[model samples]
Target chain A: MAKQILSPLPGTFYRRPAPDQPVYKNEGDSVAVGDVIGLVEVMKSFNEVKSTEAGKIVKFHAENEDAVMAGQPLADLE
Target chain B: MPIKRLLIANRGEIAVRIIRAARELGIHTIQAHSTADVDSLAVKLADEAIAIGPPQAAKSYLNIPAIIDAAKKTQADAVHPGYGFLAENAEFADACAVAGLVFVGPSANAIRMMGDKVAAREAAMRAGVPTVPGSDGRVDDLETARRVIAETGFPIMIKAAAGGGGRGIRIAANPEEFDRLVPQAKAEALAAFGDGGLYLEKVIERARHIEVQILGDGHRAIHCFERECSLQRRRQKVWEEAPSISLPEAVRRKLCASAVALAEAVHYSGAGTLEYLYDDASGDFYFIEMNTRIQVEHPVTEFITGVDLVREMLKIAGGEKLRLKQSDIFMRGHAIEVRINAEDPAQNFMPAPGTVTELRVPGGNGVRFDTLLYQGYTIPPFYDSLLGKLIVWDEDRPAAIARLIRALHELQIGGVKTTRSLHLALAADPAVASAQFHTRWLEGWLESNATKLAAE
Candidate 1:
């Protein structure tokens, strides 16, 4: 079974915590529930997107710094 | 070369305002919009629309490169940044210049000069404008801050050196408070503006926030008179009125002249406002700062002076010099403007962005509703909460207040919480009715009457 982690807000999605930092969860990276996957930048503020289901990250749906709408999938976990 | 076609690098009512002004001037308009604003009123009404970038302002409205690229692609001769976003950005003006497009504002040099509050204060002082007693320049260390506070006395204003729009300000009443507030103010300033530099100024109690509207064409400038913007909520103006009723004739003239002097000193062009903190106790006014863009409350000045400021801005940008001499302009009547924000006042003024299910705008004599909202239009949640501005004009302040009350009663909106009812309550309040309120009055009034206003 696969689960999709959806963005909780509409804004620019950043894979890294900071520009210089590496991606929070990379491709094929193992993830746990309550893990910070990425950040959604909106109105100069960043909201962390966390995985709700424990699984291994299969792939990211949105590219780094890509603008994403609310409920848009951020990554796939299988 | 004149501006034959204009690219509006903004959104909402201001973009619509620019488009209409350009249309009246016989110039075509290209509205630059984000994906979220594709169906906006400005985009639909424009002669052409271009998708600049994504929904986020950083990638769209504030994306200078994309905006200039859009202007070039649309063959726009000029770009009009209608307030906020990139309006006062010196780099945007420079980019427009580099791209061979008129920026429809003051020179990049002027923007740079006024963008920094400390530098602007220096400019005002050079122009012989009275400024609030404070540190001579940016306070470099805690020692300097302490010394300035001591010299200026207690209850001082600790302000960010490179701040505007009411952010990065903290008041300190005593030595302990001053010591506690300086680092916090500096830290907040550093976070907000990337500059921890601070300045100190003596806080004038019960001061009135007044500003004068000035139009310049690089040759000379003239004042359109003054506006009383004292009624503010947390330093943000909620209501503004032109030809401040409380100002004496002498003080008013001096204030307007000082504004003109400041504008002339900068060789400022287009519509700009010079804000002042007027102390009624001493019958003196101190220059606060200059806004290098058309203000949200400009309509009140237009109503009182009968000057279409936007039209004048276009004309000035089109290589025409300002034709209105100082003697030619005259104040006609009283005018008031109330900002209608899409925020629930009772909910800590939280933004209530949503689709407008219905909008019954007020009409009749001297009533104008400047808005971009329409039925079924979904207001994106990524911008300022200002849904519209309700302005009214009449023979006097009392009449204007009466008319404004009637207009507020008639105006209707749905599907989102607004400051409409709050404005109604304020308008009906005796302090507001008598034009007797200061910048901090509204916050105090809300503290006492928020529940009552919400219940009503």
Candidate 2:
């Protein structure tokens, strides 16, 4: 079964903190529980969406600058 | 003066409605979209489109500087705030005036007067409009609250002085409940309205929520009848109808006339709604507050009156006099509106957002669907879950209800859950159909029917 990472609030999804900065995580990247995976900016505040389970990222379900809702699957991990 | 170009400073169905109206008047429209709404239907329909900022409304639609900059860059002469965001915001109206762009609503002073609940209540009292008996003003402490409760009697409602939309309120039936509820209500008021200022009011049982729509041209005003919005959940209106069935003809006239008097007292211009809580037992009504903008349920009034309220607002902002007199306004048919949200009713109204794989909207006769969705359009989950409003009009309430049922059945949206089933259930309910409900009726009905609804 794939472990899904969901958005905490409604906001724009950012694959990385800044446009030129390295992404916190990427497809095929290994991550542990509580590791930052991406950022969801809401109301000028950047919230880091952290991984709740240890896994390797299989897919990023949302694209950069895409609007995401609360509980939307942001990424798929295996 | 006709509006040469208009900028919609909000999003969703209201934006589409305004754009359609502007188009009919031969006025060009510019739509400001957040990053998430680049491909929205409103953008596609506008004469021009500009990306304001990111998805979060605070950075995009609600950001004064960004919205003003968009209007300036697009050279749009007027900004129409369609109901939400900065629609009723006084500061935004002031900013628009300073920028030399018409705000397309009430003056900033009128908005400020109605925005503050305490001040509005005081104003209503001074205007000889009946208000719910409560504390003199903002209660100072527990001692003051205790005294107020003693004087006002039990089963009183504690409310935030600056709050609206039913937020930051608590009902206490006795001393025990009052002690426990006051602190929580105060904290919520502080967090939501930025003011812990609290007031007390005797809770009116089985009160129907009715509001009168008034249009003004700075010098004079007239009433456009009343709308019954008693069917609500979480204090947010879910279904609304014109010509409330529960109110008597005399009461309705009085309520509407009182609303016009209040508007005239404030020299209110543009479109505004004076909300009231009406108790059927005593045929008594009390002023609640005023919504100083084009309301979400304006379509219902438009359906009955055949008046293009948005167009009238634009013309008024352009310094035009009232075209229609008081006697010219007449309610014809009964119109009902259901807010279709991208939410799962079975899952505690949880947001359900996804791509629209298929889309079908009802048409013909009195069926109308105002939406910004199309096939292949992804519903960005960043903002409100309101997909659109489904409104139907007919000669009577029963006919309107029948039409609504047919319309809901004909409407189809795929790849996301919606409130269609819930609305269907509510429409079929005897209480809703008979128009026998209060503000808390829907929430209670939803809770009790949750099990049966889930079984399906």
Highest DockQ, which number? 1
Which pairs of residues clash in candidate 1, taking residues 3 or more apart in a chain or in different chains? none
- Candidate 2 C-alpha lDDT tens digits along B308-389: 9998998898778988899999999799999998888888877777888888999989988988788999887677788989
By summed lDDT, the worst window of 10 consecutive residues in model 1 chain B runs over B447-456
TM-score of 1: 0.90
- Candidate 2 reaches a DockQ of 0.20
C-alpha root-mean-square deviation, each candidate: 3.2, 5.0
Off by over 4 Å in 1: A1-78
lDDT per residue as tens, model 2, A1-78: 688999987777898877767988879999999999888865334778988889899999998877878799999989
Q: Pick the candidate with the highest lDDT.
A: 1
Clashing pairs in 2: none
DockQ of each: 0.27, 0.20
